[model samples]
Target: MKNLYDLVVIGSGPGGYVSAIRASQLGLRTAIIEKYQELGGTCLNVGCIPSKSLLDSSKYFSLAKNNYSSHGIFFEKLFFDFKKMMDRKNEVVKNINNGVKYLMKKNKIDVYQGIGSFKTKNILFLKDIKSLKEKKEIQFQYCIISTGSKPSCFPHLNFHLENRILSSTEALHLKEIPKKLIIIGGGIIGLELGSIFNRLGSKIIILEPMEKIISNMDDSLSHEMQKILEKSSIQIETSLSVSNIFKENHEQISVFAKYHNGKEVKFIGDYCLLSIGRIPYTKNLELENIKIQKNKKGFIHVNDDLQTSVKNIYAIGDVIGGKMLAHKAEEEGLYVVEHIVGKKPNKLNYDLIPSIIYTYPEVASVGRSENEIKKDKIEYNIGIFPMKILARARTSGCTDGFLKMISHKKTDEILGVHIIGDHASDMIMEASIAMEFRSSSEDIYRICHPHPTLSESFKEAALLNFENRSIHM
Candidate 1:
């Protein structure tokens, strides 16, 4: 009984730690298990936090090297120290790691640094991460698994850090900026990492097997973003299926691919980054001991309440595989915690959870995409306003994208909002809030948005959506 807890959460990523904290707050004796030495998992350690830190640092360096001159700001010479940027990124991650540890202590949740394996529906054994020796046994009335995901690679390719076939994790820790980087797959991970290196003076070539990069998003977004990235001198090749990747020598890598029409091409670069996708990390949990059910994709199966086949156990975050966004995982963590406490929290609106890509001009969308609405066969009206027309855009010199609003033709209710522009990541929350309340296009149009702000574009788009007219254009 000494090791018994009301709840035991496995994995200390955003989802796991957050659920543990909430459980403690709800007066449950809780504990969390982490296999890594550090507390925060991939998101804080590598995926979101480190990536954004580098992104911001690289963006500043780029502005000084290219854009400041047009604003009457000129420097005799502009230079950046790549080492310092990486140092700052590491420091940021370290601070957040310590912060998570402090939260565990503050909340009085027992922290176990080991791999947790199920022994029964109500019992788990913690083993030393490296030795695989059982260290302790723990019991819990309920359990939540949030062991996230890892970058996936092709079946034939073996990733060795020395050979420079990089995943996003390896790409983040490069000692030097590559002279040329070849990126396979142009989803959020590939494009984001490519943008970072490109801004830092690396020649970037992106090969996407699909017809468009960011293919899951709105078609308009794909078209506009491709144009923007290409204009920035990043080479993008679509409809190419990579056949093989091999090291030509110690310093160079080669990628061989074929086009849809069967034309073969080869690309050589200093490094090849594989960003095809990620797989749910459900390894070493020994789920078979307890007969936990998982789908064919290795993601644990959970019902409407996020309950596993064994009702007392639940799974959240990338292990269960939905959006795979940190925020989405965090929300699911909260939902599971509140559900356990009988708080009866509102069910998550999966459709309204926003998706964001943090390229130079960010892309974000919430609610249904235009294509999804079309697939549903719903009658809808569309309104689009370019960001360039806004005075705020001209003032800031960020005039490359637009805001598009889709609404029901009959009821006038806003259905989806898509944007590609400055602050698109932050700007998307407005649309999410509007759609969450089932607000109409006229409602957003009538709301007063401050002048000389990027958000006014939202109002203009809403006006155009409902009335088919815009005040600015």
Candidate 2:
């Protein structure tokens, strides 16, 4: 007997699993397939979840080692066990993985664990990861590719060297912190992993090809974050392209690079982390057989409806590219499922989606940046609030960032909101809500905010757009 499904999702990541559940909810018989034993994909396994777990644990340790002394809390001996921390992180990953499995069962979505490939228009070939020769076939009306992405490595530093060369995935599972760590990219992953071990006593040196870190974000946020990381003893060398990586000894590796100015530089470290970014992962999907149209970069081409060139087959998440965010993929999954079920759901507001960096004094932003508005020649008014004056920040001693609001100069409608301070990730959601309603700076300013809180800074910043006055400063 041949098994059939209304929708068959390939790659049980955020996009795949969510789409499968939604499809089943919409009265479609759905099935999801994963190559790995776990369903949460890279984000739950080695990317966002595990990295954030370690980062959060290290942040508290750092506070105990540095800030707690000022808060009148003294420790006789402050020490942390890397093994315990890693174990806790692994435990967290397992819990989330199990939760995902529960969701699939509750939704009655059939899950097949194996490598899936397209053999024809409506047929899929499946094989066990261990026993590739053992094959199974399934039929589906529609398919979604959401394999997610893998950590990109420098061309010069291959995984063949093993321990000396690390990707963000390997870095998260390290048994011991390196005395000196050299990161090759100054993007979100590098900055985050660097912050983790730096707090745990590793000397971090970031080598960025760009002139500024987080170059895609608001210039102010990047500049401020760079300064903060520098003060935390995280060295950053920008505008350099790596020329070669040489193994110095069993204990150290030498990195050679050149500045844009043609000056050669050398860096030696116990370990090197390559966090340049990620590429679309469509591994073993047999994309060539179907001839699904792909870009030069291997990203599957999808239209507004998330449908690829093959009408019934769709692609989302990192495989199709955008922000390479898990939430973005989740939204795309829901969107595709709804569209397939004949529901008229409004298109997602990509501009309003928030991007967050989980470093200490977390960074978050939504909508167009001031520079983006400037490039478009949009006359915009700006409201700025320094976090140093916030009572909550003063009490917490984490007053190192600010909140900025940009709005249409004449109408006062908010165009963007950028934050870099404690609870910035949580606080940005409020801004996202306000912007979703097309709220003006005046609108947000008039809303009541609790006193002695980090969020109050946004209200004050919004007030700046109207009266150029903030009550505190």
Instruction: Summarize candidate 1's per-residue lDDT along 1-473 as a digit string, tens digits.
Output: 33999999999999999999999999999999999999989999989999999999999888788888889998987889999999999999999999999999999999999999999999999999999999889999999999999999998886667898999999999999999999999999999999999999999999999999999899999999999999989999999899999999999999999999999999999999999989999888999998899999999999999999999999999999889899989999999999999999999999899999998889998888788999999999999999999999999988999999999999999999999999999999999999999999999998999999999999999999999999999
lDDT of each: 0.94, 0.91
lDDT of 2 by residue, 302-363 (tens): 99999988999999999998898998999999999999988988888899889999999899
Please provide TM-scores, in order, for all candidate models, with all chains considered together: 0.99, 0.98
Q: Which residue runs of candidate 1 sit more than 4 Å off their true CA positions?
A: none
- After TM-score superposition, the amount by which residue 203's alpha carbon in candidate 1 deviates from its true location, in angstroms, is 0.8
Pick by lDDT: which candidate is best?
A: 1
Model 2: which residue pairs collide?
none
Residue-level error in angstroms, candidate 2, position 189: 0.3
Give per-candidate clash totals: 0, 0
Off by over 4 Å in 2: none
